[model samples]
Target: MTEHLYQPILDHFKNARILCVGDIMLDRFVYGSVDRVSPEAPVPVFHIKRDLLALGGAGNVVRNLASLGANVFFSSVIGQDESGRMLESLIGAEKTVRSRFLVDEHRHTTTKTRFIAQGQQMMRADQEQTHALTSVQESDLFSALKNEVESVDVVILSDYGKGVLTPNLIQDIIKHASELKKPVIIDPKGRHYEIYNGCTLLTPNHKELAQATGYPTTSDEEVSKAASILLERVSVQHLLVTRGAQGMALFSRDEGPVFIPSKALDVFDVSGAGDTVISVFAAALACNANLEVAAHLSNIAAGIVVAKVGTAVVKVSEIMDAIHRDMGEDTKETHLLTWDQARDKVMLWHQKGLKVGFTNGCFDVLHPGHLKLLNEAKSQCDRLVVAVNTDRSVSALKGPARPIHSEQDRSVMLSAFDCVDIVVAFDQDTPFELIQHLRPDVLVKGSDYTVDTVVGAKEVMGWGGSVYLVDLKQGYSTTSIVAKISSGSRN
Candidate 1:
């Protein structure tokens, strides 16, 4: 399989504009060292060192979108207080975003203060009022939203339930978005799931899905049933249930449910992961990606964010690197790129001296064998692009139970490696179309098969390009690992 395929998608992120409307909060982190207990109370005394604050809630969604090169317009509520002033300063400094905040004296700007010691969060303090917005405040917020709703390609309802997303406000936004026929994506709160009627898409985590349906079962069938209920109940055109390690499942009106596995490998803190999801989703929609493709791109973005601690955002370079590494394409010839990011990168590389090399695989579980193959391919090219098979593709080729690691996990792990350059992931049985477009100088595959049998070998060779079969290290297969685990469990 060709690798390093996610470049095009990452390139697409540049210059996109997305409108975010909902509750915004500030995440304040107090970092310090704790060596002794407090004399006044039963608490560890923290010697404060540094303090940092980042956008949280809906603000985070906009921030993530901006990081990926999208021009973001944020519409939310804040108070005329210190924290609110800080929020404005923080967001104003973001050159990619324009803010139209409604100042409400009745409610303070929501802020969550987290105290961290030795890289561990000790406690969190939340300051906010979650009551419904007053009529006057709602009117002001509506007025601000009215000015931008018609101009943006997509609208995101990021409801943190912080008194900003009233039922009335949500209804009006939904109605307006419908008139413009723009996609309205929702990162729903459990309590207000029913109020997001006619949304283009609803992204709910596993816990929220369970809470919304009041179904406690963790079985796939049960979760699917619950997701269906919520989708129909809210009149949403599509529903995405985000399962932490399990990935995500997409349900559309005609396509039904398509499960996209989580890409996270080692999950540290999933704090603002949902915010990352909607931001990427809205950006993808603005770029004219299909619902399934948008969800897949969001799944890749989520994997990138969870690998970091605290509320984080993943950049387009990171996303591209992940896709390339996941696909096992040579990154040496290519710069880091995702499918959304590839068009521009490809054009630039054409002007430069670099030649793109492409390859792909499931890399279900990376072992020394896969590493040897990828390194060898990288050695033969200027840059390597890897295209990974999605969980769906793995099931079609390997088996339903194959790919022990989810797509997101596999992508993150591969992108972190130095040998890889860019990564892209595909759900098709083969990345033939992507390979054809890339028109790499070399098409690489494992030594197990002759070049004639390779999926994209003919396409590359026909273009006067060469097909190289890189040697795979012996005795390292996903099947072998599974068997070893099963044997140990039985013993």
Candidate 2:
């Protein structure tokens, strides 16, 4: 698909009110370097250095939803414990999410802590209770659902099988959501797919699909057969199966299956990727995206999350970037930049120890004089940024009929040159403010103008950068070419 395919869907994510009900847990990662083995055990001892904690499981789905700018009403069951309190605080910290936690005093809140060293996972420890919720706790949860199920645009059932989603409760939740005409998307867990029968969409990874359907789902035919069995058995509208390296398969009752390839650059951890998929998918559908479009965006989000080292969340920009790259489109093009883009590009170049050069012109027409000056400018620095005047500014500086070429055409032309690393447009009369904003390493101008007379020369000098005056190619100018064309003369 082209880059424009998902723009409308992405634009609809902002301010979407979603209800997420699931098993929320806290995930803590301990990072440190391991050099020697421990004296007590044969395995290497993990040295505790620092910790990074984030919402996981259903909480991760809420995090992804909130991170994508959705206002989420999230509910889950937690123990009356410190971890539960911390989970409460974490959920409260998110400005967009309103959380309701039902406490079971006898249970322990679920938490998973992983130890890492040099980008490799060492060990994982878990603290939790997985038994089904009691009558009172379930009743409390149902009460919360009663208050939220009718109001939200969409409902997400994030089932880690950690006891929040019981069979009867699941059926009731789906019934209520169906009555309200809200789509329910589930990131399912355990072997029971029957409880989520009425959900609008159900996401299960390759392994989960295989286990739930009792089919060997390694090959394409196996996956298709298994997905068909699950869809027919569960009576759901659609099923999206996420295959890690093999990509994703969408099985619809109307349309059999359409597969999307994996867009991940690398795979670090696959822990919370399923959460990201369901969250993005449900969010897309919540904003009125079709099944095909939602699956594509969700598959893209899943690919991004698996590349990270922990239970991670993906950003909207990251998803858009993957879509553009996956479709072989250049989103940034980098050849043309706005003033803000110029500043960011220069900052990145400086961080890499590359010298940046700056020069400005209308560049209405390509000429040997302009090429010579730009070449000299490039030779003085590692990256040469050519600032072209906008159409309005060009008209202000060189008269309305002079530029001959639009700013876009002129900028695209400059970007084609090997010497020009970056091309930016400026509407101002002079590039003095832009130069000061960028603070490039070198300022370039034609030899006709002295350093003392050149604009931004003093600022460049003040910033410890040098100025260069290139020897212009004589008898070659845009004005001369225009005059020759007007006179119908050939040299």
Candidate 3:
């Protein structure tokens, strides 16, 4: 499937109105560089550089939904402290999200402070109270929910084991949402899933699932059995388990288990990945997406968030780009780009100081050889651009019998590989013009060609770039495979 297939779904996201209720907190990150050990103590001294503040817990869910272009009503409780004031101000700044906060004078606002050095967290400090809300606070929160429950399309319970999602509040929210025929999605916390009974769906990580069901959720079979038990115990209609690297699994009573693999290639920080999952899932439900589509979209959104450094939101444009990168066909709208789009992308990468690598091939029939070459090429640079020969060009060079697959098919196949970041077809026999226009930081080719014989190597070298010749995998060649197939030989 191509990204164009998701355009309609994305359009629906713009019209969604989501009600996000749960624990809200503030996340603070202090970035610096570790120099030497402190003279007063054994700790390393950090040279303070900068600091950042963002939403945390349920607040992050509101941020994610707003960033995805949803109209969000966020309700949570915070202390009447400085941190609480700061959190309220930040929420007010978002035009798409409306805040309905209940303040408690007895507690301090939850704050998580992290010390990061060189893009890594050195230490963390947290200040929070896990006790349930006061009677008055619970009543106020429920009143707010009752007022907004009828106006929203979906309700999300983002539980961080914080005090806002009390048992009574959860029950009331579920009942109200169900009465309004609005789906309720819960980002569950704690060992007991019974508190979230009657909710439409519950999203739990692998560890949480194990704790809730008391079953070893190490394998799919165990998870399936455990989820089945939890389903019977709780009133939820569906269970979504998010496995860190293994991806996510969705279980419902009516349908068999559906698993969507993780789309993340490079995971930086998984701080707020759960918030992203729930936010996207709720937004998709608000847009009337089916259970399977909602899960798939949420999986993609989670994949994009985990690749970032901290609690981050996935924008609609970013989601579209991810979909395009993952499933785009060879059409002009996809990875098979025009010269203008290619230039813009290259320029963007250059502005970011990213190393771009270029390699060209006919790729008539994809085999292990092509995979090896693309993988090696991508390893040498931050971005890899594959320039494919058009069908006419391939026929002119390798004869009419060559290129069993059309240019569109070949480009689509190459774009499907994770190692190939961008695919562009060239009309000429060689990608000389394409290489010159791209001016990639590195030029790559197979070991079959020397530095001198490689196409566009001199031009790239003149521009202070270098050429890389990856060693070919022995006994594997496209020509040999084609010939073998034609000769009906079993090798």
RMSD per candidate (Å) reads: 18.1, 10.1, 12.5
lDDT of 3 at 332: 38
Residue 483, model 2, lDDT: 87
lDDT of each: 0.79, 0.84, 0.85
Off by over 4 Å in 2: 37-43, 333-491
Q: Per-residue lDDT tens digits of candidate 3, residues 1-491? A: 44555677788888999998989999987755687999999999987644557899999999899888999999998988999999999999888998888888877899999887654668999988778987777888899769898999999989998788999889988998888898988999888888988989999998899999899887888888889999989888999999888889999988899978899988867878988998888888887778888888889988888876567778877677778778754323555876545654664555344778999989998888888899999999999999999888988988889889988888788888988888888998688999887788799999999999999998887766789999998888778888999999989
Candidate 1 structure lDDT:
0.79
Could you tell me how far off, in angstroms, the CA of residue 458 lies in candidate 2 after the best superposition? 40
TM-score of each: 0.67, 0.67, 0.68
Q: Compose the digit string of candidate 1's lDDT tens values, residues 1-491.
A: 12223345556677576788888898997755679999899989977644668888888888888888888788888887999999999899888899998887777788899887654668999998777888887888888878688888888889887778888898888898899887888888865577888788888888898888887527678778888777667788888888888888888877768888888877766879998888888887887777778788889889988876667788877777677767765565432355645533443343243556777888887889888888888887777788889888998898878778887778788888787777778887778887765667678899898987998888776655688897778878877888889888542
Task: Indicate the residue-level lDDT of 471 in model 3.
Answer: 93
Query: What's the C-alpha lDDT at position 243 in model 3?
Result: 87
- C-alpha lDDT (0 to 100) for residue 109 of candidate 1: 85
RMSD of 3: 12.5
Residue-wise C-alpha lDDT for candidate 2, range 1-491, written one tens digit per residue: 55677987887788678999888888886655678988888878766544557788899888888878888999999999989999999999999999888988888999898776655667889999999987777777988877787778888888888888998788888998999898888888888788888888888999999999999999999999999899888969988899999889999898869988888788756878888888888888878888888888988898887866456677787788788787777677545676655665665455344778999999998988998889899999999999999899988887778689988889889998999998988888888888877778799999889999999998777656889999889899888898899999997
